[model samples]
Target chain A: MSRVAAFVFRRKGGKGWHWTDIVTWVWLVGGLFIMFGPAVWLVGSSLKTPAALAEFPPTILPYVTQKVSVEGFDKPFDLYEVTLDDGSKATLAEVRRIGIVSQMVDPKAPGEIIKVNIAQRTPVREMSFATENYTEPFTHFDFFRYLWNSVFVTVVATLITLVVNSMAAFALSKYEFRGRTAAMLVILATLMVPLSVIMVPLYSIVSALGLFNSLWGVILPTVATPTGVFILRQYMLTIPDELVDAARMDKASEWQIYWRIILPLTAPALAVLAIFSVVWRWNDFLWPLIVLSRKELYTLQVGLSIYSGELNVQWHFILAMTVVTMIPVVLVFIFLQRFITTGIAGTGLK
Target chain B: MTIDGSGKTGPRVGEIAMAPVRFAMGLVDAPLRKLQKVAGLGGMATFFLLPNMLIFGIFVLLPFFINFAYSMTGGSALFLSDRSFVGVDQYARLFDCSNYLDPNSCAEDTFWTAVGNTGWFVVLQVTLMIAFSLVTALILNRDLKARSFWRAMFFFPVLLSPVVVGLIWKWILQRQGLLNFGLYGFGFDPYAWLNDRTWSFAAAVAVSIWAHMGFYTLILLAGLQAIPKDLYEAAEMDGTRSMRVFMRITLPLLMPNLLVVIVLVLIRAVQIFDEVYVLTGGGPGTSTLFLTQYIYETGFATQLRNPGLAAAASILMGVVLVVLTLVQLGLGRSSDKNGGRK
Candidate 1:
């Protein structure tokens, strides 16, 4: 009887084990899908034309092609034959101007239109899958100039930030002066005060200085970021004082010490800070939006917002633009990842 | 370590002997030695700091004073000639200046509402963000395979622009967005995530967490790695369970980092604008209208051009931020002391 009971218990245990193993596998797959699914969709959507994007069910890949329109308008008016009394057929351009629905285009079915109106589907017309979104701007159907400006601003800003921030950090870290603590405290204090607090005043200052609509308008205010100063100073502090003293004793000038001794040693930290600064300045939206009034001066972020405006947000173009904007940041991140982990760990600084 | 003829230990002779005669050099060298001890040894410190000081004064300090002055006067959008010297009246108007057009607009209510909404946003976002990041950090720091890959995956969100974050999440959470599409597929009714009054507020808080978790994770992971391995070994030898070990050892050790992360998160959460702007545009109703957004609309939005009110709002926001920072720093200090004791 005891052996019989033991056998029964063993059988139940085996069944439970089998059940849990199946459940665990299901959960593992489900969790990963949930986490990485959006990233995969973003990449996939960028390759899709408007027709293929976010259609009723998401597609596994972007494989659809769109038809081109070529045979619409040779003569201005075919009115008399068609309408008799009115005799004037509305030209394609005139129809478009008066908000008439296109003849070839289907007026969305009532149910579908309601869903689209409710924000389910973004209704950008499908176009041929060319890289025109990346190149064409004269016709203004897509982005080209805004991307160029973003690249210019990012490269210029990153270079300037590295030099200015490193210099300030070197001074703060190596020197022990009467106002050193006070200066450090002030920088830290700025971290607490958000830019929103002084944005109006900042705008007024920029306007007064006549920097509106210029690249310098965006670049100048951010040159003195408190966060950069904090990061650089902390990294510099970990450098031994003896090195500077030794360099000085050898008759190396302060500038020489900064250029040769200190700069070389802090390369890893500087790289990390550079990545931080570049990514931030490149991706900045608000300040750039306010400073650059001219459409031509808009950076990638602000331009992307304009592309997303309610009247005409071309999802395909927007996604393509997103891909274009993200590529540089992604490449920089991959390059900096090796140094960044150490920097973040606080080990590299010391 | 082989030394060359010049040697690495001391400065080369010419650097020390820039002056003419040996007699004058000796006289100059003695007093200069004392000057070199404190600030940048000798004259080195003064010159290196000169540029930084000038920039800091002009950009940071001078503006700080100006901000205070503007707060005092009823600052206008117009130039100095058009400004008036209404001392403290501007500050008073902050509470009383309701409908600039309507006599009964009740300005004080709007200001107070903004304050309440901002506070709620900070509380919800900071707590949720810290929780998400701490969990991710703990999981990533575990002695598991593919730890590095997971760490990289988790940290990727921080690399994206906040505007991108806002936009991506906006696409997902809009009334008929991916969330509803997914839900519909699963046979549930579609929920409006961005347009509903309550859901809009909640969605903003959620976006702040998703965007910020990576930075906090990095900070916490550093703190986690700093804990010595011996403690864990000892806990195991004493037959303590994993949960007990984490509670007794890891929690105490990680407190300093937690304080840093918390304070930073709080400060950032209060200043959230980019996500708020791109997501709902503070819409449906005033449900998602954050303080910064309110100030932005007042000062810059095409429809609402109230520079004086905006300035007052900004000054008020600044004061609140400063006070909150001070309080957090104090709490952080006490917690740090407790951590040291453990």
Candidate 2:
């Protein structure tokens, strides 16, 4: 074991560490590595050149290109200019390495090859950054468009979710009416209906509603999630009813009460709902994949998936895009982690 | 309705100036209040709930019923009018098999293959997930150094998109990827982690567990925290061994969360699609083709695009989910009753 592992297992005289403590530390550290190492590797690999990425005994760090002199083909091959038969200088287009000879091609004259002595030529190592892996995808593909689509869909869907679910929750919790229990039960029951079951018919419905190939097709179906209703309802139940009665005495309309009084009070719950909603809508894939036939309408997830299939699989580009796609959610999680942890635990218990 | 002693009872100049506006408001309110009186609070409640119920009814409830209806019909059309009614024929086709034990003997052999693959997936995924999550949760519940940071590290992947998670793992597990690179370093030949059938299936399950174990661990951690500290203290006072205390006290107290985790994990395992779809595309001869992927491919991918058969398969999936959910609710109820007794 390494020094850190030894330290982890080490026990002081008074504060003696038991075998279980050592076991626990080992499990925790191992589990954390397995959970977190891939993401770190992803970010690292994204920064490497395609050449360095394909190198045997693959490296974890992005390779820094360094220029070095070699005995054979001593000059930098890419920058070498060849002398043409017509006495014109041509850029070296291709270099092929055989047993003891090097063949260089001049693009200016495709049919002619110039032989270079390997032992006599000076080859220099060229080391530079592969920032192009990050830039090429955006310049060549519709990356920003996908990013914008994701933002729009996530924001609109979350706002609509908060408004609609909170309204329903407000009524369900604040009012006693016939079939109120039944409606609540029905809504809760629908939570059990996994998206897989209703997906086909839901597709048909969206098609029939003339939303095919539209971002609205993706946004509309997810606006009224049962989990949102359940969470907001549970929160809303804790708000004192006397406040609503006081608002009623002020002759505030029902809509006014919901909009001004209840919604403002449920801000914390709304924040939690907003975070969950944004994550769900942003990370959503299958629905958008089905609804968005047009490439321009594809969200980040679908767009990244399409990028995955482009010609050859470019691991560097894919990793870069994955990092790009994860930034927003990570920021959100970091900012509101307290709410997320508590909200999830709360829902699980309930 | 009474005014405060220091407050003015009569309308101010601004209010008097708004008399016409108030009259118009009163005209609107009169009919609304009369309607409220006639229909009562339930009617008002329905009004408040209309928007949510309308969307939910259209998207979820209606589609749920239409899914069943679609399963009973036969055709490839997206519209119901273009299809013909075929009672239970789709179900019959799904269950049609020569040897029930062998998926290849079935007419819809891919469906049975999916069923078989998912069965093994659920078994392995749920078992490993529960065990790892429990162990991790218990460790995190300890008074260790950098405890919060370690907790966040384990929980971070749960926040990632499933597609991203799948892609990350695919990059790591591919033939020339990191795992094989590590093997090469150790003087071992590269193993085709995803290209092979068995390894691909196992990779799918392993990836699922990695992506989701955090959420379940958090649940288990919460359950662990909820276990009263006094119980452990009492056990300590009685000179109970740590192992005995864990077995007798912690395990029993954690049972409710454990049951919830099991059912949730099972349901999610059955619903596994995005990660596996992105990672393996249910390839290498349908070894990792889950039921959800089966439904998606049957309805969307193939040229035939058989909506009826897909609907039937989805309904079958729904049946399993509903049963699991009921068991979850039952567990919740029993736990609640137990809490009440205590």
Candidate 3:
């Protein structure tokens, strides 16, 4: 094979390195930071206590101020290094304060309290990962319920979508039938009609059906995706007609032909559709937000939005929940990363 | 089952896993055969097609036509019959601006602002997204180590929910957020990145690019790899500069994929509601409110929703989308015929 272009691969120059490799290295490293840095920082911030989160210049790592209980004090006193008015520094536990002065006591001898201006002391701190940030939401918020609802919607919708779309694709691609052209045309024509366009009417119809605040309400409407049928139909068109004919000759029913012969043959495309469906259903917001108003039925996307969108926002909890909301999709991407490019190119949906 | 011709080696893992599926199909097989005998081949086709058609018709096609009816009627009532027929009054209200260019002069000023914001957003976001995607695609297309890994890093955000994407950026851009914290550490004042109007709008575009550029980059990378190596070799033999060769060969070859990316990004950019909604909440005096959010706020979020007016705005948005779709189909047709527009 001809050598790869110098431009495409790293090439050694007479000196240190080629200019192109340097630029590419810088570009990749810089992109890695810009793309992934915010999220890494977020994980750090989420692991911080609420007070740590509120700091003006927050640390890159989570840290909490140290507190110590002195010999006499029943309550834990915040430990701080304080300078006395006589110009001596000592580690003292904070006792109480009046106005700007903070009353401090040495741990060994807690009888006497020294009053120092707040600015004259620095609080001792230690690095601590706030695991409670991740756990507290489970008890305090509807995060787990939201997660279960999202999982239910995504899994059920994808399964139904696969069955329905594959059946439609099989009919369109494998058989000659009445209204086939019309049916196919109708599906193809509405390919670009996103839910945003017809949301108000769809909402009315869903409400009329008494599916308001229902998970099935979110699942059913999106199952008959035009893109799914289109992709599957295009894939099934490649299968030879003789397979179906042979299956028929073997006395197999039409359903059998569809289930055994065509379905298995169309597995790669199905995998793509399944991946596509999972991501779309998992990440879906607008439709669920419309249909499921009750908080119990709220999907992760809607719940995460409500959490972050609130006034007097709880940053630490929101941060933790946001991390939870995104992890599944990211994990899905990593596992199915190979198939996703094909999924997008096949359907042009995303 | 016999036609599968794979029983020679006994039951494989797939066949074993599918045992229940086969059994279930067997139970239905007799009835289905009887139905096929009664209804013939045409009926079988109909059977296969009906479920999808039923759902597609009810959810997608039916609502689309009903959307027009909703637009034509007036009132907060959702069902078309409950509302009185306004017959284009909603459209008229949308167009009732004294000066269309100045949203302030319009009676429905928020609608105009949303339209204006969507317009600017589509222009800036689509343009920059394409440029950045192309550059990233080119860089990734190079015979570099860990190419797929780098590609995955970019594509990962595309998988994130718009809400998550929004919240991630919201954390960074909020006052006392990480971005501000960094600025403060450098002795700079912590700026309210999301609160300022100009910065908020810019953030909307940037965050949008951040979320979606990976997908387009993947498409363009595929296009880049598809270009024959011989063409580049020929250019090299002719002593052509890389820039000149890219303009002469690479650009033309990648045009079709680039067109698809552009149109998709345009359609998506116009419907920029969720992330920006979470990011700015269309805040700092409505600097970043796009078309979808306006319709959503009008039709649902408000105490008294004006479905008629919202339907009209969405109808207008639909028209724009239809035009974009047609362009894609047209370009897609030509692209298929020649493998590229040229």
Candidate 4:
């Protein structure tokens, strides 16, 4: 073989680190940052104060170099003191109180100041890096209530979908009953029908069923996902027939076979479906937005939109809220990412 | 003679009955003997399909039929009061070449314009997305260390909800955003990425790619893996160049996956609503006004009671999608089954 040909034919595994390998490593590692950089920026900025967040070139780590200065408060008298261990206050008179003007108050204030807009509660005196972005949602607002409501709906919807779809998939896969092909066709063909066509009517149906704004509102419509059933059925078909037959020989019922034998074998496939359902439910914005009207019942995605107005957006708050909201999904993905990648690809094969 | 005939018939009948009993007993020991030879089949089929059937029927089948029915009516809240049967009036009004009654009492040209914009977006976004994903997948699939980690990194963006993706990217592209900050560092002037009409559309498409190309990448990677490595080795032995190998082997083998990805992406891009809704909100004078978002605006966003119009628009969009999806499936199936051989 020619030298070039020999080099090309050489098994890649045995090739010690070469120029190509080094370039590939750089590209791969750099590519990781390219993919995750925006997300990192988003989550990082979320933890920052509005001023720190607006800093040019953007800092990933907390800003320790700059102390934020607040101005424009009418009252400026100062004699700041913190009591030492002796319990006698010795004054350090140079420090003065500065009130940062929140967006809630206008610059053209005084007459425009509404009683409802005032920050009546005492502000935190400490300057420190904290998880207030997360905890504040729990303490200061009904963010937890919204989160609970979202969780309740998503969990219920996903579980119901899994059960119903799995059963359907099982029936379609295993049975040679009448209209079997027709039933499968009906399920598959519906995949093409755009969800927009049914949004209005589905909304009307939910209202008609008296399920609007209730947990049932979210759960009922999403149950029995044809896609899920299709996936589960496809997965179930891969199971060996003899395993099921052995169970039948032991006088075990069909349900017993499903619960004990089939479901266990399908765990890998089910894990994939679980990730899909969780991510989809967690990120679902439109359907939930349509179904839910009450602020307290809003999902994280929907509630986050309230901070996003027609024109003006509070970037700091939105980023903070976004970071907070992404936590559960990120955690879920981290735990189940492997299953997620394998499941869809594997299921798609059938 | 009569007694002889009766004795002969009885003897024949008794022999036949004994034969049948032996056959029945022979079958008794087998597991499925009691089940009419298809024992668990009926029950098991029901278990597999029952859930999907129920859900699909209620959510999918029912909605399809309902939309078909709604398409026939003049279906606005106000029009509901009129209660007049307008056979194909809505679909007609959608394409009525003359001045249809706008609330402003002027000519409203919605169909052609919306169709034009949607067509452009579908063509642009789908092609870009597929090309982007395929290239990325090819690069990633190359013999490299830490392939799994890099794969995960590329695929991570796919995990983000479109809504969240829009919100995050919007921040990045905002006037005082990271983009501007970075530009300022290099002494370059900041540009309006999402605010300008042309740029807004591009920005929307860019966001769609960022949010979803990972999915296509996975699909393409799978396709790449399926290609026989032996083919590449054989080509190399014959002194076939790298580019030639890619063109001849890789591209052709990857066609099936490419078709699927293209079709899926096209259909999805045409119906895109969430990202545009979050990012530009179909702004800068409707430069980024996609058909789905247009329907949304007419129905929900604009606070106008033109749901009838919105419904009409949605049905039209659905028709377009259905046609596209059907064509894709038809072409895709035929190509895979026969194209390579020919």
User: DockQ winner among the candidates?
Assistant: 3
Chain B TM, per prediction: 0.78, 0.88, 0.92, 0.78
- Candidate 4 docking band: incorrect
Better of 2 and 3 by TM-score: 3
Tens-digit per-residue lDDT, B13-101, candidate 1: 32232223234434555455555554455356665555555655555555555666566555445443456667777668766744543
User: If the candidates were sorted by their TM-score against the true structure, best first, what order would they fall in?
Assistant: 3, 2, 4, 1
Q: Give each model's clash number.
A: 10, 12, 0, 14
Task: Estimate, for each residue in B10-53, the C-alpha lDDT of model 2 and write its tens digit.
Answer: 22422443345345545665566666778776787887798899
Clashes of 1: 10
RMSD of 3: 4.6
Assess every candidate by TM-score: 0.77, 0.87, 0.94, 0.79
The C-alpha local distance difference test score for the whole of candidate 2 amounts to 0.82
Candidate 4 positional error at B248, Å: 0.9
Point out where model 4 deviates above 4 Å: A1-30, A57-60, A64-130, A310-313, A348-350, B1-48, B78-84, B97-113, B335-342
Between prediction 1 and prediction 3, the one with superior DockQ is 3
Give candidate 1 regions above 4 Å deviation: A1-35, A63-142, A310-312, A347-350, B1-44, B97-105, B108-110, B189-192, B331-342
Q: Which is better, 1 or 2, measured by DockQ?
A: 2
List per-prediction Cα lDDT, in the order shown: 0.66, 0.82, 0.86, 0.67
Over A120-238, each residue of candidate 4 has an lDDT whose tens digit, in order, gives: 32222333454566666577667778788778877777766766676676666655689988887887787777666667656655676688887678777777666676777777888
Docking class of 3: medium
Q: Which one wins on TM-score?
A: 3
